[model samples]
Target: MASERDYFHLSGPLHLTHVKWDNLYHRKSVAASLVQGVYVQEKDRQEQRKGPNALAFPWWAFFHFQLLHTLVDDVDNSIFGAIYEFKPPPSKCNDTLHKTPRYVIAFRGTIKKPDSISRDIELDLQFIRNGLHQTSRSNIAIEAVRNMVASVGGSNLWLAGHSLGSCMTLLAGKDMAKNGILIESFLFNPPYASAPIERIRSKKLKHRLRIASSVVKAGLAIAMKDKKSSSFDSLSAWIPCLFVNPSDYICSEYVGYFEHRRKMEEIGAGSIEKVATQNSVISLMMSAFGKESEPLHLIPSATLAVNFTPSRNFKEAHGIHQWWKPDLCLQSKLYKY
Candidate 1:
């Protein structure tokens, strides 16, 4: 069993490119003026030659986000995400290479704009309540991935998102799976909609409520299981890679657990589980009471957990740039190549 920590081990050229893609958010010059939706620096090419792996910038992901920026006059309104195509480039170590590309869809964390923040909140609610087609933005992402895949048949897909975007990525995976398209997800600091702890007055009261809620969750899970079983076999095909910071309040209770578990079980497959060490007891108690745990922090067992030590500055810890720090992403084996 590969622990979440094992997934981030950076070694080959492909992993190095991922680190660069993570940092692409900071290079506004590059992100804004993309050559066919992606920019490749000289350094990026140099890193490719250092190892036997070959990779390409996903113009599909970058161009779509760039389109979002154009549609909305405010930069803050941008829903940030980009797709990176990972593969082995032509090299002596890898002479015969298949052209099939593994598409990685990455979403940005929270930004400073008020509208963007509000947009995230809106999308979160829709995701929790109505599922995938609830928001136009999510629809756009799904359609984009679908079209890209259709254009290039037999392409393996991956999803990555941070903060609110994590929610989007997870939902996209669900929808993609429903369409019989399998995808792998990499989520960061995703928040879940949990029952308000303040609502529970005492442990005794909480215990009673837990029993009642268990019935409801079980019923709902069963209903969801039945509903999804007809459509898809196993969510295990959609491998979930989760990253989290223990101290971050935004991800105290990961919500992606129940839904994913049901999906995976539909096909008699198992892999989903929590990866974050922080909020374990809290999440357990919440689950006992049938409340949703943290969002992406604590999900299905199959979830590859990559835990991070948060910064003292709470805001910095949750910021997208903070997670991309070399000390964090570069420490672990990022790709299996």
Candidate 2:
């Protein structure tokens, strides 16, 4: 079974091109102009050969708190400015964890803009599935991969994304599974998933005053369960492996603001509108001018954890947000493949 440490521990660049399979892949590529929605391919190699495994972390994941810069169809906004591309390591990574090469692709596109709802249905499954929508990132992502895989062909593919990306990742998985496409694994963290199940106690990761008994019960379940039974079972031991954070206040307050704003139709109450405005500035500027990427560094914090505050400006907040927690000791967990 794969451990949380396995994924949470990886610190470095990951390519987003992993989601597409080889037979469906045709071009050698990496890197996208965040300012420009266009992606630039790596020099095509004569012999199209990929390493035993690959992981693609797009610009959005690599350049967090950055910008969103992409324009397509009728969708236009400043929510997608800081996207960047990842380069896979050369030479095959031959090892045990490399159990069938895995490729992860993250989409940095945004569907929910403060101004537009044109693509809302396609962006938010809820708009069509449950509520109005989750985010436009998912729809944009699915289309991107369909186009990408149609152009590249090398090997099997595995898709992974967080937040809004989770739905996109699931979409890819379901489609591939149904079509019998090659897929390795999916690495998702605190998906921005929208469903009736998400609102239940079973889905909430928050700690509470009344849940002490529940937490104790959860811990006991972990102790009694056989760790080797199944992946989900072994992992459930850490149920509510809660991250009571000092920084939680900001998130908590922010959630309230949005909930209020949404209910009252008052977008001006919280600093969210201000922040979103600033973010839009960044996105617009970035879309017009691409930026350079610094070395990737993983920062661990509850802001990156599940159900963080400030639902806008960012998609998924967990994953590599805080890659160095003690319980989240990733040193031994990463590099399985």
Candidate 3:
């Protein structure tokens, strides 16, 4: 099992930028400049830790081959997504240690707009069992990632996203893995495929809907297992790590489902198992139905439940302040894990 410190360290690199969907296009120039600054700072920061026994950051995985590309929807030429590729460095420990460039693809969270990525998230939630519609923004993100990978000779990949982007990260990872690409995905406060039923306003309706949702979720889980596709859920190397605030309704609370816990454990993500349990209504239903279940996303390799110090502002903690805090403009120390 991993402690909070391990998660904090693993989370260091991703903290380079705050991820939000629509804001991604609008803040491109600023984010690029910020990444450059972080690159320089990282070099100096690593040098300070240099000693015979000191661990080093994967600079080659992040800075040396840093290439940012913008993707657009072919239909309307709307900004589809942005991806960062890190071409493998020539050598590290020894001259012969070859490496493949790792791609860091991020998706943005939902925005309250009629024509934004949030709409796609809602659609994904509506059809959690089937996943996003082909023309949904989430699916478009998958196409963008696939195209980027193909252009680079189909190298190994890494993924990170915030909020709805986090959900997109899972979908893209699965699609890429099905195509024979290995990946490591990191998600920050990822939501369940379906929206929370706590807001339904009627307990009876909520319970019935929960049962309905559970049946649909279980059926989909069984179907996926039957297909035996090379989705991320079925890949050994496709490790995923999730970071969430303890009180986050979208992720933290939802992990209670037996299916969600089973998915995490199946991937050997023992770190998250501590916080997850088998008591959720969905898990109970799956057992009663005699169907094995799995989560909407791959079980993470590790789950970091962060409880920010000093202040526990719900919205603030739920955001990716662990990386970059836009409201405070504060950046934490970067670590190489």
Query: Per-residue alpha-carbon lDDT of model 3 for 1-337, expressed as tens digits?
Result: 2222222235334443322322322122222222322232222333443443222223223334453764444543333345665443445333322332355565545533334444544554643443343445666778777776787644455566666667667777766655667565656777754455543467577556545554554455454343323332344445455555545666654333333345445666533332232122344345457654434443423434343343466675555534433323221221111
Tens digits of lDDT, candidate 2, 158-190: 344333333444454443433444333222242
Query: Largest TM-score belongs to which candidate?
Result: 1
How far in Å is the alpha carbon of 210 misplaced in model 3?
Answer: 13
User: Where's the lowest-lDDT run of ten residues in candidate 1?
Assistant: 34-43
| Top-lDDT candidate index | 3
**Which residues of candidate 3, in runs, are more than 4 Å off?**
1-67, 73-80, 86-102, 113-121, 127-130, 153-156, 194-233, 254-295, 298-311, 324-337
Ranking by TM-score: 1, 3, 2
TM-score between candidate 3 and the true structure: 0.51
Model 1's alpha-carbon lDDT is 0.43
| Stretches of candidate 1 exceeding 4 Å from the true structure | 1-79, 84-102, 128-132, 154-156, 195-213, 219-233, 255-301, 306-310, 326-337
